[model samples]
Target chain A: MNIQTKSQFVAVASITSELSAVMVVAKEISLAAANAKAIAFRAGDKAKGFQPITDFINELAKETIDLVTNINVYALSLYRLTVNEYRRTVAYNKFDLVVKTTEGVTYAQSMQAPLENAKISMQNCQRQFKRDVKQLLDQLEAVMHHARAARVIAANSRIEASQAGEYLQSLQAVAESVDKAAHTIHDNVQRCRIALSLYRNS
Target chain B: MKMTKIYEGSYQWIMFGRDANKPSNIIDSNQYAVRTANRCLLLEPGGSELFAPMMAAVLHHTPVDQITDLFASHQDPDVISSLGLWDQALSNAKLHAPAIWEGYLRHFGCESIEYVPIPDNGGTIKLDSVELQLIPAHYLHSPGNFHVYDHHAKILMSGDVGSAVEAPGAPMYVDNFDSHIEKMRYFHQRWMPSNQAKRAWIERVRNLDIDILAPQHGRVFKGDDVKRFLDWFDSLQVGIAV
Candidate 1:
């Protein structure tokens, strides 16, 4: 395999690794949302605004979790396609060598069909890989959107926690955890997008 | 790659080996092709490294589309690792390999070609008018191995039974059996894993009237050298590593 092909394999494989971390952080956000809801209930009227924010936080986490789960499956299929592409490329090169070596032979022209067919198969795999990467990028963009919305929810959470009196410390801690989890999800998804963007429609 | 016409009548048996451009690291192997009027069968089509030169040599006799059949003696990489390339090249070919090795050999990539699994007892591959017998040579080196024998051509394409390790550009046929003993002795003793399997294989091949004993590697044995190889192999103790 050449350097570019090796890089392509590594890029496709790294998607799964990066996304698993995103999944864990999203679940942590879900747990943080539940803890905030309990503190909001204890503060009663003081944390009324924070109760709705907790639901939003849980909803964003669920959506991010679902998106990452689907992307992981797509990434696995992309890896398989990469393997198929490599095999087809190798076959095409070897067939081309045969054509060159057998130039003066009697039945040399007969290899044209297989050669043409291999080239087409290899091209198909490349095109399919690019199309899949584009779709995966779009899905990752959706996760990034959820991460940004989460940051906004964390800011609103801090404002509401100031009015909760005795429950203020617990609510503020929940807000901080959500903000940190969102930042992690944002960074992990950004890495996946960067790694996959190279092959998209190229 | 050197091409030798070992048999010619209604059909032809051409051996391909001694590739001048082959990499130094890998062991050399021989590939054989049986070409009839309309169809061709490639026996022990060789490793992935030899695919290019082997295919180039084969085009001298038949076209890619007419290359309809492939046979693997066992699941060894040196024997049939080029299977993935062949699977892509020949759209209508059938691979006649051991029944036990279908799952294992598919790892080499065999999607397009039909796999004709040879049962443990043995089977036959009929290419147009010529019929070649798949003689069981299990545990010869691989647990599920076989050899091809042409009744009409009187040649046995032995998998590794009569094999030797000769240097590059070695002659196609064994010139002298006595001097060739040392080259084959260590390989057979170390690789062939069963004395009982060796005895059974010798007894089975003794019944066939073979004029030429062909192997996947090293030199071919013709005329009296065929019997001489059998006699030498019969007395030698194998599976010595245990």
Candidate 2:
């Protein structure tokens, strides 16, 4: 059975590992893009050069890192906030309605930054490009295409936020799971309130 | 404290890697001061806290001017980023190193130190009693990396090879060979890095007849365990399932 706490810890660690790799990749890519920028600025009507080739490869690596980091950070945040809301109900032994609502609300808020960053990086694919050259321009164009795709996927972050409301359907559905314990609902609410304040204030 | 085993070379010994238990602590990296009778050499002592934490360990006896050559095994932050920082500490420190990672040292701003290039075609240098053999072990961890050996001590500073991600109070040397081999076996199974690159370097290491293998990460490998670790390292495919 997938308990909430175990699921959250695994999610966080996985996100951290993915972020670490992306950070390394981003640095590699940044180096490449910087080198390519230096070369394209100085190509001087000469042949297509190895100097820019270094940059292009580095940029490719960075772009890969950027996409991974953005999504993971955002997703992990939502998961953290959403589940923290329910920690009280599990404690008071009230596996009922109110606890389910707030968790769903928290899950939706965590993805804001990653979704935004993905859009910004995709835009950089064009902003960082040099115009009018066939070879380098074509390569940048390909990079820009992928960046756009990332932005499109991140557009769904808001939709995920909207789904948060529906997940809190404990108003109608809570009576089914905890119906036998419905008589104790008043006691658990007070317990839930005290626990939630301790958590929120922290 | 146990007797400090002094390596006869000029090592700056900049420390790096997973260092720091407290919130406001310097990074966890150590610089090696490899000394010889006539001269002293400094190895990669990472940049962040090289002077405060690392030099505090060295400066109790000697000053920076005594250091002549600076050597970095590779371009890792835990390995060599402090080349520039060490140069700033010593006025006349020259960098003696492999050619592969020279650009990175320069990138870290080690312009004051003169670059001593090692010829890959094969060469040897004697710093008095200690004979230094520059064995190029590229891609065992990263590209352009090499390991330094002292035939006198029968020790090969193996860089990142033969490493284990052990915690504090971990054994430095094992008395029982079998249990030690298991540590190394598990270590290499997960972290040998690049296979194609390690194969060629393993061949070079086989010919060296080393006694002690001192890697940067975890415990140093010695005796029959050294051979066992090498054999285990050789048999496994590069990269770990874990």
Candidate 3:
């Protein structure tokens, strides 16, 4: 009920509402990417649907930043490290997903043989998008946890919140771990795409 | 009063009334409360200039649920004067106090807020982490005046019995008794000059191990000062038991 809690809740509700939109956009981009890959598999020649997915993914990234800023404003700073780490991972992964999906379409346009193989590569890129979205959702969950704990801290000092501080620290550690894991995946994929680009041109 | 870090969570001690530093005209003794619980509680919130400040502070502590409990030590306007504003913000918190003081709570246009009368003797309220016990203060200041006993903090927030005339910025705790004894005596003579009432309340206080003494008008007395104040009050006689 305190001002901090009230303000934080309003921001949380805003984030939740905004997340619905993000999810919808992400789903559209995924479907678009899938459709583009499906066309390349059938005809081995279309690259038009690919650009829309990349453009939409770009918009999603911008929206993601706006969401993070809102979270930071209402944030408790308890999970600052976790949020920052996840932010990096999500940003990197989203960037990788966009680059890879775009490259898969380019790969199809330039290559003549193994058309189905190019579609498979594009499908893998879409999977990367899904992975990044999951990471973002995980980060949002951690932020919500800290927000709730901060609310308890604001409402009354009588609460035993030192324990909650420990929990928040653990949340950061987990986020860092997830970030590192995702970073490795992202980097390996980026290098593979570079090699694939070198092999197939358009 | 030197506002100490008695306790604050996500809720900060926010003041919402106008010129809250000034002695309240609505209530003779001006004191403001910072409400941070899921359900904020207003103490002596009044219609005077203090109304807006109390609302702002309460608003800071209150979100969707509104005020949980509207509380006052007695029926005095200074204590329950702002009941009107609180009733509007958190219609469900309800106005609660002794039956005798019920009229004053209702006096603030009892449309939205529910009025609950505590037995003349006492009542217990369970807040989120703390429990509030209301003990009758009898005639120390008003008929319905009662001390709010916070068990966790070991504090007894008496209405006017402990207000001092020294600088308004007087310390709540008395690390040095001799330093504040004069001011304490001066205040007791003017405000709580009833020997019988003092004796009765002293016994009531003695039954509990009080760590702090938070008077409505002055600073809270903590640690040794709390014990010493009681001993001093025990020795004094006020106006032939009148």
Candidate 4:
């Protein structure tokens, strides 16, 4: 295998590793949202604003989890495509070598068809890989969008947490956890995007 | 790659080996092709490294499309690892390999070609008018191995039974039977894992009237050397590693 082909395989495989961390953090955010919702109920009128923010946090976490789950499946398919592409490329190169070796021999011209077919099969796999990478990048971008919205929700959660008297500390802790989870999700998804960006259809 | 025509009547049996450009690390192997009027069958098509030169050599005799059949003696890489490349090149070819090794051999890539599984007892591969018998040589080296014998041509394509580890550019046929004993002794003793299997295979092969014994590796044995190899192999104790 060539250096570029090796890199392409590594880049595709790394996305799965990075996104598993994002899945875990997204679930953590979901758990934090449940804790905040209970605290808001106990604070009654003081946490009225915080109750709705908790629902928004839960909704964002669910969306992020769902998006990451789908992207994981897509990443697995991309890895298979990389393997298929490598096989096609090897077959094509070997067929080309056969053509060169049989220069002056009789029936050498019969190899031209397989050679042409191999080239076309290899090119098709290359094009398919680029298209799939572009789609995966777009999906990663969606996860990034959710992470950004989560940070915004965390800020609103902090402002609402200040109003509750006795429940203030617990509510602030919930807000802190959400903010940390959002940062993790953002960083992991960003890494996935960066790794896959090289092979994008652009 | 050197090409030698061992048999020529209505159909031809051509042996390919002794590749001058083969890499130094891998052991050398011989590939045989049986060409009839409209079709060709490649026996022990060789490893992935030998695919290019082997194909180039075969193209001198037959085209890619007409190369319709492939046979693997066992699941060994040196025997049939080039299967994936052949699968892609020949769209309509059928691989006649051992029935027990169908799943294991598919790991080498066999999507396009149809796999004709040879039963434990043995089977026959008919290419147009010529009919070649698949003789069971199980546990000769591999547990589910086989050899090809042509009744009409009186040639037996032994898998590894009469094989020797010779140096590069070695002569195709065994020039002197007695001097060749040392070259084949260690390989057969170490690699052939069953004394019972060896005895059974020797007994079965003695029944056939073989004029030429073509092994996958090393030299070919013709005329009286065919009987000489069998006598030498019969007395030698194998499965010595245990």
lDDT tens digits, residue span B1-242, model 3: 12244545544332222233556333334343435555555555654335444333333334425356666777766666656544433436666677776765676556667787888788976566556788888777666677777666566777776665555444444557776677667567666656788899999988987776766655557788787788887896654434
Q: Which candidate is the best by lDDT?
A: 1
lDDT of each prediction vs. the true structure? 0.95, 0.49, 0.50, 0.94
- In angstroms, how far off is A94's CA in candidate 1? 1.0
Task: Kindly list the per-residue Cα lDDT of model 1 for residues A96-199, writing each as its tens digit.
Answer: 99999899898999999999999999999999999999999999999999999999999999999998888999999999999999999999999999998888
Better of 1 and 4 by TM-score: 1
B1-242 in candidate 4: lDDT tens per residue? 99999999998999999999999999999999999999999999999999999999999999899999999999999999999999989989999999999999999889999999999999999999999999999999998999999989999999888899999999999999999999999999999999899999999999999999999999999999999999999999998888
Model 2, B1-242: lDDT tens digits are 01134333343222223433312333333345565544666556555433334443443334445567666677777676655445444557677667766776677657568877765533454554556777887766766777887676667777778766555545555467656556556566565567887788788888877777777666666777778777877777767764
Task: Give Cα distance to truth, residue B41, candidate 3, Å.
Answer: 2.4
Best by DockQ: 1
User: lDDT by residue for model 1 over B1-242, one digit each (tens)?
Assistant: 99999999988999999999999999999999999999999999999999999999999999899999999999999999999999999989999999999999999999999999999999999999899999999999998999999999999999888899999999999998899999999999999999999999999999999999999999999999999999999999999999
Over 4 Å off, model 2: A1-202, B1-3, B6-30, B121-126, B175-191, B240-242
Taking all chains together, the TM-score of candidate 3 against the true structure is 0.48
What range of 10 consecutive residues in model 4 chain B has the weakest lDDT sum? B233-242
Q: Over the stretch A1-202, how does candidate 3's per-residue lDDT look in tens digits?
A: 3453243334334444454543443344334334433433443223333323334333433444454455444333323322333333332333343333333332222222113333444455444433443444455654343333323322221121122333333323322332332233233323323322321221
Docking class of 3: incorrect
Clashes per candidate (backbone, < 3 Å): 0, 27, 25, 0
Q: Per DockQ, what order, best first?
A: 1, 4, 2, 3
